[model samples]
Target: MNNQSKQPISPTAHGHRLVVETLNTHPNALRRLHSPGSAENELSELIVHTALHLDTVQKELVDRCTWAAQDLTRVATGTAAPNSLGVLQNSGLQIDLLAARRADAKAHLRSALAAYQRVTTIAKPQHAGPHPPLPSRTSPRTR
Candidate 1:
């Protein structure tokens, strides 16, 4: 007979895993979206728009993570009888990496925003709404 505990996954944990996976896969696709002239065409423009939307969402999540870490640091150090701040101190490496990733996410979002704006400017559609344009040959322009 099996004796292992059949533990259920917490929704928070599941969501975290999903976010991590999405973040992992998005960078490559985002790079492709950023290729020159990608916004000139409709399909590439759509990909860029979708990638931009996804990037914005990812940045928001990364911001939340930074906030949570800040709160954790406070709880670990600000209390009268503070909890083990050692954990945070010991994991300094990971914390630093996370901070770097947060910054990287911000930079990526800025790039995506620029791409979306460029797509809108160059691929102007007849009707008003957010849609990607066709990929066309152009310079890598940014604000």
Candidate 2:
């Protein structure tokens, strides 16, 4: 047997796996395809979840920033109330905070994306040749 040394899993991934193992008491697709509780399958699910969560956070921040920007534009164009100085100030601050949050979310998303790519690479190992030999059918890429 080839005794391959495995790399250490990230803390985030490990914690996520713990939750999965605890909750995955039933026979799900992951269990059916990758045994009762495969660590790789659990990690894959965590990576996907983290990436999607970041996507959601980024979208929310963008929506909030857009609203704040619209408010500022209205104030600038004198369309808003004359006594809306407080609203203008609050809108600017709100935009700044939203931008900062979006930046942080982007950083986290990049990390999660990298982790996901690494896991995918490991799961589907690099093929020696450009195209792998098929059983009998021609490769779709060649068609």
Candidate 3:
């Protein structure tokens, strides 16, 4: 048999076996692909969950702010009830809070993405073989 044709066991194969062993031994590995109970995976999942929740909240805040602005406009135009002023003011405060929360959530989402990227990068296999060279274009003169 040609040495080139007979390949050695791949690192990826070893990694697969290791993952299988880990899944068999770890209590929580069966619950999720990333091992939900593990610290790193759990943190990543939590961050994603929190980011999604924050996105929903941000959308709601935007709607509320729009409604509040419409109410305030009505108040200024003497179309809204006098008691609506207090509610509009409180809505302004809520809008400010939501803006701050959105900023924080974006930051957390970035951090979580970075953390997850690191984990995936670490798991990826590095190719050891030399890369194939690009095909050369034959010039008219050469042909």
Candidate 4:
């Protein structure tokens, strides 16, 4: 008889794992998305958009962490008194979790920005100089 019971997975935990995995794999995945044609440009554009979106998400995570920390501070200082020890402890635990999440989000955001920069560099023209004039197609006799 199997005595081990399966533990339920939280949706938030699963989503976080997915996000981490995606970020870890993104560079290779982005490379794979590039091809010999217009797809490279499209992929670079997509990466830029994704990086911008991640920046927004990171900002929100920072805000959440700040709020949670401030709330925890208030509770600790008795500025916002809790009804019981249990409430205070729970609030502290929640704040700790928020801080952890904020750290993870920041790391992910940095990775995304790096990827965006790499892709944009790849998309840029190889020659930095001004465009050369077109060679004259007409011969002396034709001119």
Candidate 5:
């Protein structure tokens, strides 16, 4: 059997298992039997995976930031009223948590970008004639 017929990549981790399962289905369709561009297709799949992962991370970060902003707004609007000190303190703590989450998200994004760069650099498509272009990872590109 062709290596292209091999099983798809799947992560064993609980949440990732479902994602893995979804991605694994319909491999034959992804291979494009007529085209037979195995290497290029594989690279495209990787890029797609990276993009999705980054999107999820960014969404979570945005959600955290929004929640923090809402809490702050409530504190600002309500603190002038009676018995608001405890609520204000809780809101401050939540804002701090959101700030930390934002920082974490930024770090994760940087790491994801670095991983993408590494994949592009190390897996050269320079010689892939008649196939899709694989971004080079040999050197960092000027943004």
Candidate 6:
């Protein structure tokens, strides 16, 4: 039998997988409640919004990661303490929970970066300065 049939999936694991999938979805498609200010998107406005979002997401991920690090230290140093939820769970469980949270936050950050890159791609058009005039058709071309 396949691994799926071999064992039952825990709700926590299932939820963690869902969170990862949601975060990995295309940026524009993530929140379907609204469009980028109507179907006709304003490139500059979208870029600004996406950049702001990236910054926020990055900060959130960093914060969450910091928390996770603290938890890791607690687990590693064999210090007994309540997890983020104020539950005195076993160290193993605490570490697993913290890992899942960190993974989700990192996934979100990655998705935000992707969204920013997408919106800013067209924000600026690359143009080589004016090209030299076409070569003189006449044989007497200047050296």
* Candidate 4: 10-residue stretch with minimal lDDT: 1-10
What is the C-alpha lDDT profile of model 4 across 29-92, one tens digit per residue? 4445456456454654454444444444545556666776787789789898755657646656
Candidate 4, position 103, lDDT: 62
Best by TM-score: 3
lDDT of 1 at 92: 59
The model with the greatest lDDT is 3
**Per-residue lDDT over 28-97 for candidate 1, one digit per residue giving the tens place of the 0 to 100 score:** 2434534465543444444444444445455555656676577677777875344466654645555566
Query: Which window of 10 residues has the lowest lDDT sum in candidate 1?
Result: 1-10
TM-score of each: 0.33, 0.48, 0.54, 0.40, 0.37, 0.32
Better of 1 and 3 by lDDT: 3
Candidate 4 displacement at residue 64 in angstroms: 7.3
Model 4: per-residue Cα lDDT at residue 25 = 34
lDDT of 6 by residue, 1-143 (tens): 22322344333333223323434323333334235664224432343345344444445545565676777788778895645764434444655665665566555555554554565454558787999998678767666
Q: Candidate 4: misplaced stretches above 4 Å?
A: 1-82, 128-143
lDDT tens digits, residue span 33-115, model 5: 22345554654454345445544554554666676577777657985343445765675676576557545644554454455
The candidate with the higher TM-score, 2 or 4, is: 2
lDDT of each: 0.48, 0.52, 0.56, 0.52, 0.49, 0.48
For residues 64-142, could you state the per-residue lDDT of candidate 3 as single tens digits?
8888878878878999665734776788888988778766766665665567557656766887799888666663454
Superposed by TM-score, candidate 5 places the C-alpha of residue 118 at a distance from the truth, in angstroms, of 1.3
How much RMSD separates candidate 1 from the native structure?
15.9
- Rate residue 20 of model 2 by lDDT: 36
- Candidate 3 accuracy as lDDT: 0.56
Model 3 clashing-pair count:
0
Count of clashes in candidate 1:
8
Q: Between candidates 4 and 6, name the one with more favorable TM-score.
A: 4
Q: Encode model 2's per-residue lDDT on 75-131: one tens digit a residue.
A: 689998544447657767876786676567556645654564466468786668567
Which 10 consecutive residues of model 5 have the lowest summed lDDT? 11-20
